[model samples]
Target: MDIQLLTRKIPIGISQCALGEPVRYNGGHKHSKVCTQLLGRCFDYVPLCPEVAIGLGVPRQPIRLVKSSPAADAEVRVIGVEDKNLDVTEPLMEYADSVVPALEQVRGYIFMQNSPSCGLRGVRRYLPNDHGIDSEGVGIFAQRLREHFPHLPMEEVGRLNNSEIRENFLTRVFAYDAWFRYVEDGQDAPRAGRVIEFYSAYKYLLLAHHQQKTRELGQLVSNARALEPREFAHQVRGGIMEILAHPASRKDRTNALMHVQGHLKDYLDKEETAELTRLIEEYRLGLKPVSAVLTLLRHYLPRSPHQFIHSQLLLAAEPAEMGFCDFH
Candidate 1:
């Protein structure tokens, strides 16, 4: 087996604190072993602390938003004032806004959870009129990142704790990186060969994951030769987005596993095949698709180099935050 084929490189942006940097509100860090250990090998990480960059020094004054609504039911934004006090946020927003343009290199970002300044989801906001709430705000920098590059895959470190969420995130990240490499990264023309090579490797994988759009996307790329470059470019990019919109789901993943099982009929013993078939059925019934398919693949893939490589390709192509382990 070629060692290089076993390694896949994905570019990711992570919150500095999650990478073990002391950039949290209290001069601490929320370390994620999954990111530092399991995923680190497969991904080339780019770490950032938006709060730190926005001039909020470690152990600085805690900031919160007094939302316009007294009921605390709307989305939150940070406000510098509390109890009719002073405001101080222009510098922060200015810095946050400036940092986003520099993140064009990142295919995905991992954010801190529940941070008033960096939370990717559900940070709190207070009502200054004493409506009595301060925990439902969006981190200013995270919000800006989403607004700037909605296409890039992103997730919170906390979300990675769930195996399925981790798997989904990793799947999107890897696919997004491939896309940037094949379509967006600098070359003026789409390299039809590389795109097709990737698609061919992923064709069954895409079908298994229930990405009907991805299958269509493969066909579109395969059929692009007759069109002019400018014409094909728009169609191809749009097709890629359409595929991305449908993150691999459990039902799709089960079908993918079953497809692989069908391909293995000539290889595994009757009893072994029966066991795997049962697991695939369990996945269809909602018994965790990642572990189920992986159990079968791990059992049979080692027996054939071709099957092994194909399995690895399907795995590494998945988003890290989508599942429990690095398929790569």
Candidate 2:
């Protein structure tokens, strides 16, 4: 596939603070160069600040999650730090609900870490007595959005700093966007045929993430006619996103790469085959990066005329845009 397809700006949601906006409680920005400079190249950001959206002005009082009782699952509220009486948990959730329609266009969302309103997870939670837990809370607004858009790809700016995590997140984002464009948004009604084709394209990509789940999904797609079209589509979509959610392990990736190599075995000479196998083993042993194997595969790709081999997303340059070239 032409890598240029991914160059078309993908619309994604982001915390305004990540974009260098002064939307935080202290009227400061937690500007992330990664969000604004790197990922921004392909993503057209739909910036949002739940705190500011909920009528909390810039330089507003800071809020923290406070547990009503010291229980395993206590009712946590976003309470004003200094003014104990002010609680905006419900308002934050309500604001998240209100933005659902607008956010529907976003394939993924990047949240600000450690935020009371926008943190994806691991925000600080405090006991009513004011003692704080190290990290045991999810921001109210982020929680609400997760509940509403369960399958939408979400990540924290802090987490995206890691190359592997960033690549995995982008892979999910592109796959999510690909599903809607190719299968769900087809001119005709979505059918088993389109779903199968879509799955075929992502087969090795999924296998690299989770082998058992990928095989199970293969069976699900095989029996697509047994379920209603909409239901089948939903199941397939959920499965694909879930599989891609796990970062592709080096061992599993080597396995997927070997599968790709199998397709080209008949097309390569003895020396070429041995060279490819050596590189794959080196990658499996961490002696080399996955890119080395991929580079060798691309050299052999043109010699193989199998369309299916060519169709694999794993072989395409498009994934390189997601930092797959640097994936270790």
Candidate 3:
């Protein structure tokens, strides 16, 4: 329930072009004001350009991943479309491999869409034998990043324009940022006490994901009085994966609402309770979760206000309740 954290800065990775650099194929940028304005207020951007890092100069020879053969599997060639000169695939691959490991500090990555080098998903991967391609592919660099940091919250700039997507990504980034410092810092063994302390702060967020697994994780932490670093890391990792198996959905919101409703039971009247229940029910059936919760809170809080019971306080609701969201 650290409301101050939402006001804290989040470290986010972004494509160089997205940061207003002229790194695109046509030497232009798709500068996003929303990213630079609203979200930027809370994010410290780390800009990267894989192609440029691999020694491609500004306005350099354009390269595209072309199919060498259909049967060659993923034998895509990064060749210059004009002169048919150099194949830069090997260098790009090597560069991506190097860069991914160096970016362990990043909790989230925001990539450009449809880029041959930086797209998070759905970049075309040409096959081996014939001039065929598969759209169900990710950029080589992005793939390497994901493989190295499997739990990092990754998104695209285009998608981040949506309020829900933006909020979700930001949430994950901050959560991961906190985990890195509190749980995985290597300062000491993540004892049951420390793990519980962190979990207590993130209970409600975890409930939206996997409540049962969250409890199991807490139990493991309690059971391990003298656990080694490796054992602690492994258990924590499993708990994180389970929490991130799915993002927040309407069902998750309804589950979360049930918890909050229980907390508000003594505060609201019968008529108010019915409206709140109906709102949560609607959210369970696919309406906006935030809207439903906000509507209820607005109508009731002024009459019987408890600052500690605000949605802001939900961030610290406990694992079973907080299971509603995940970062890494």
Candidate 4:
């Protein structure tokens, strides 16, 4: 059976300010066009500002994470930049706990960068003497959310500027949604057979991401009969997500594309085979985009009668409009 990816609007969490809301401490917003224009087309954002949620008024004093001592494992506090005595660390973390239930429906999240309350990483921390240390803090609210949903596809809006990171994040988000749609959300008890079927769609995609880990995951799937259905599903989902956590390197992607190309060669004429092989080689050498090769491969996909190739998610995982082809 061909696995269908979610095409409906995916509900995801985002910082209110990133959505152009003036929810910042200074009554300004760091609006992102990528979030508003690009991702907004596919995602329904549930926006929130933890500071605002905790009753901190808009235009309130800015807060920063502060290390009480210079020690490596010092206690960090979210304190007012102007008035160090004003602390809201607990409130920020508390808001994350309270809001998680509402956010349970969201499959992914995009955080605002450099926020003491929401940055996923690399937020600045301050020393007692007012010295600042860069890239030393995780936002209090983001930290709590990580603890609550370790597998969620979370990223800072700033990092989405990179093509590979943006594509990888969206890939994970789609796969996460696909899991619920195909396996997790089924009315029947989760079946090992169903989970394996789901895994089939992702096989090539996983190979593109990490060949070694993908092989290990295959081993796990081979033993799915030994484990309970729910446990098997959980293990596979975790494995799939973990493998896709990093952007696939060009070398690995070329390898995967070549493997895919092998399946079609048997059905193509000599000229067709040479053309396809040339494009794949060009893509491997970075002389042409992967899309070029993928387009030709897809054009020939109908000639062959392999059900597995027809079911491969790597071919149809991304929507054309997302401009994922332009990324590489």
What would the per-residue lDDT of candidate 3 be over residues 176-288, giving only the tens digit for each residue? Answer: 77776767675665555555555655555566666676677767766665677557665665575556545665566567668767767898789989988888777777665
Q: What is candidate 2's lDDT per residue for 1-328, written digit by digit as tens?
A: 3222654688999999999999889989989988888888778999999889889798999999998887887789999999999999899989999999999888999999888888988999998789986587888999999999888999999999998898889889988888877787746668778888889888998999999999999999999879998889888999999999988888888889999999999999999999999999999999997877887898889998887888788765235635422322
From the highest TM-score down, the ranking of the candidates is 2, 4, 3, 1
What lDDT, from 0 to 1, does candidate 2 have? 0.86
lDDT per residue for candidate 1 within 74-129, as digits (tens), equals: 54456544324534355556766777766788778888888766787777666756
Query: What ordering of candidates by lDDT runs from best to worst?
Result: 2, 4, 3, 1
Query: Please, what is the TM-score per model?
Result: 0.69, 0.93, 0.75, 0.92
**Candidate 3: deviation at residue 221, Å?**
6.0
Question: What lDDT score belongs to each candidate, Candidate 1 first?
Answer: 0.66, 0.86, 0.67, 0.86
How many clashes (backbone atoms < 3 Å, residues ≥3 apart in a chain or on different chains) does model 2 have? 0
Question: Which runs in model 1 stand beyond 4 Å of their true positions?
Answer: 1-9, 70-76, 81-90, 132-136, 189-203, 210-249, 258-279, 282-328
Candidate 1 positional error at 311, Å: 10
